[model samples]
Target: MLPEVNATRYVTPLREGGSLPGIVEADNHGTYVVKFRGAGQGPKALVAEVISGELARRLDLPVPELAVTHLDPIVARAEPDEEVQELIRASAGANLGMDYLPGALGYDPVAHPVEADLASRTLAFDAFVENVDRSWRNPNLLIWHGDLWLIDHGATLYFHHNWPRAGNVAQRAYKWDDHVLRPYATNLATAGPALAAELTPGLLEEVIALVPDEWLAEFDFPSAEQARAAYLGHLRTRAAAWPAWLPGAAA
Candidate 1:
């Protein structure tokens, strides 16, 4: 579980970020890297980060610790930067934010280890099932202090728009041989029990609420109601159908 840190204390802006990410330092002097709502990518992506990111973590995949941060730009001003001052000022009244990934550098999938391969496949499985936001070029994998870290999950399960009112349950077909998917089918199957354990209705509801109401306008979800229904239904269907061909299916 992540401790609630006051975002005003340690959230400093990254000068190079297109979405204006910040360095989040807690009172215990622990640090994390964060991306905020009013910054670069906007609310929809942030919503995806919290919702999909948390769900993936619950599935026992290798995801960095994440938390929703409430920030005060005035406190953020103390971090000291000529450029970030403008960004912090520009963003106010936004509570939708995430804890940062510390000591991580982005990398290509081929460069990572076999464990990294398993993690990526599990991620792709989650993406395929949910119609996710990750891709080969934009895998969002980070190498932090010698370990692989997964980040930026704002783009998964995009099928809500295609059939918003269709069903409370959706079964979108996925290409098993996708560059990332083919290699990790076995890993995904192995991880199914953990994934199944976490996909409860209560958890899904809480994840959905993490998205601020204002972000609905940016989402392509047909109508707000339909989008919400479809997104939740998609996850449920995916969880129900956890691949059966796993090595130890009887276990």
Candidate 2:
């Protein structure tokens, strides 16, 4: 389970994305970028962040540490903006907090070229999860201490948005021409099997278990366990069909 921390202060809103995440200080004396439960995307987005981020960590990918942040309604009083205040008030409960990376620079492929192997692995991971947000137009990656770190995985596992048809789309191929790392992913043939082999049923379950029950409750699954089972099943199916979905695998 992720460590729980209460919000001690709300700093400012991060205007980079539409969700309106904010910088916050927690009782643990740690600063974080908190993705609110009240955002238009709701708690499901938070669930994807936890599952995908943790899975990346397990795959030896860099990702910020995540925690369950508790927000109190009183924090809304400090905000003068009625719109922001309303968002804060609506998110007066469990939210997702990503450890803030101070001084991290946005990744620019031209300035910081990625290695072929690393790029292939990254593309493979995104393909497996059906993440559609890592395009050049909005690359959700950061560079800290000269190392790449994946962020903002809220757009992943999109199939969950329509559970009834998740199976039909689970095997859909990833469109990678616009991927920020596509040019550097020349070793997908090697990276695909290497990464897919690591995503065992047990490993998938371990990663899914990291998501909070409250977020899982919003889904139609009868229980959190059932929801986890569904996620694992979809991922397993995707992994088995990797040759069809992984970009550059045939090359």
All models: lDDT?
Answer: 0.57, 0.90
In candidate 2, which residue ranges exceed 4 Å CA deviation? none
TM-score list, all predictions: 0.66, 0.96
TM-score of 1: 0.66
User: What is the per-residue lDDT of model 1 for residues 202-237, given as tens digits with 9 covering 90 to 100?
Assistant: 777666655555555456655666556656776666
lDDT string for model 2 (1-251, tens) is: 98899998998899887999999999999999999999999988999999899998899888999999999979878888788899999998899999999999999988989988988889899988888999999999999999998999999999999899999987788888899998888888888779988888888888898999889988689898899889889988877777778776655
lDDT of model 2, residue 146: 94
Q: Model 1: how far is 3 from its true place, Å? A: 4.4
lDDT score, candidate 2, position 65: 92
Candidate with top lDDT is 2
Candidate 1 wrong stretches, greater than 4 Å = 1-3, 9-12, 15-18, 26-28, 75-86, 94-101, 128-133, 159-169, 175-198, 209-231, 237-251
Candidate 2 has its poorest 10 consecutive residues by lDDT at 242-251
